[model samples]
Target: MTGFEGKTVVLTGAAGGIGRDLARAYAGRGAAVLLTDLSGEAGEALARELNEAGGSASFFPADLAQPEAAGLIMEAAVRTFGRIDILINNAGFGIWKPPLELSVDEWDAVLNVNLRGTFLCSREAAKVMKRQAQGGAIVNIASTRAAQSEPNSEAYAASKGGIVAITHALALSLGADRIRVNAISPGWIDNGKFGELRPEDHAQHPAGRVGRTADIARACFYLTDPDNDFVTGINLTVDGGMTRKMIYEE
Candidate 1:
């Protein structure tokens, strides 16, 4: 937060959920935020709200599934803020059908948005960051399913797994340019409608509650901050000890 007073952050999936929280957190810390999402209406509203609240913010509507969209997103961000100091590749969705019932198009849809989108955005941002000579950071939003998953999540799991792999590969490729790349695998983050969760949900986690959007947002700040220069190429799992817990039927 200390180093972000005048920085610029380009965040995808900024219409709602974790992406929304990340936008707010970055703006609250004085970063000029360029928010992008498929839901243009919501994204623009959030941007207007943030600007009204005395934060620098703008919105660009994008469909990450399209290959060319990522480049345009980076272009818009640079045009609006002059440069991109951070890139959050968080625009993604999942399909919950059983593997047997899944269609080829469905699988492709998930991969296109989740995996290809991350690559496109990171590639473009890296190019810009290298030119800037000031270095930058990239945070890819993977999922706990990348390492461990339940039924009916084959496509989602594979996409997230790819995210972790690319994080390290990009880190190595971009380290020379001072662009750090990392992934955050969040577990059981309850981004449901308000009041839809119950006490058991909080009690089930070893950390005493399910994950929050702010939890991931804070981790992003830590990993991206220039002070933590040596912390690249790592997949930081932010699960509330759930992944470590062993379960059995009584």
Candidate 2:
């Protein structure tokens, strides 16, 4: 809706499939979007595309794993858009190696980018939001794996679990400032290659289909809307009810 007409949104991992859609969704809603990703080329391209389509968007290249990157990105957003209205902690990756074979370094890498980066970015954004005296929203991209998991997902699962925890903590700490914090746990999101998925893939979920980037985008909008201020400190699972179904093998 036009609710975000004058808002400023800072999104991480802007080059990925879901991130790209997120950028477009905000920009389409009349928000000034500052997109960041390690892949400068992709991020810049997306920004350019949005601008060319008559939307306000800028690109900043930064590695979220670096401690200094969060501050720099927040500064860039303020400099470009004047203030930060929203921060989407969507940058993360998983190293799917068996626990026995997974190195300590690999574990650190996942946690650094996924968990640590979310906290640092949220902290920097909250500072600006507090100063503005206007409440804001921070949505951390967690995953269903936070509560449930499969083999070889130790690092990824742990990072997501941490995100879910940090979300509530931030919510309580920032509640006084009117800054709402929440997390979204997405499951089986089909970023691309939807055509290749089989019938069983869609049937497996109770909703009878996989999720799309739009699903997550809409959820973000709902959480960040000013009217939804009461919906903070919770994790919204947007997985088409896949997480609730009980499947039994015959």
Winning candidate number (lDDT): 2
Worst 10 residues of 1 by lDDT: 188-197
lDDT of 2: 0.94
lDDT of 1 at 239: 91
Which digits, one per residue and each the tens of the lDDT, describe model 2 over residues 1-250? 3469889999998998889999999998889999999956788899999999999999999998899999999999999999999999999999999999999999999999999999999999999999886779999999999999999999999999999999999999999999999999999999898989999999888898999999999999999987888899999999989889887899
User: Where is model 2 more than 4 Å wrong at Cα?
Assistant: none
Q: How accurate locally is residue 162 in candidate 1, as Cα lDDT from 0 to 100?
A: 99
Clashes of each: 0, 0
**Model 2 clash pairs?**
none
Model 2 earns a TM-score of 0.98
User: Which candidate leads in TM-score?
Assistant: 2
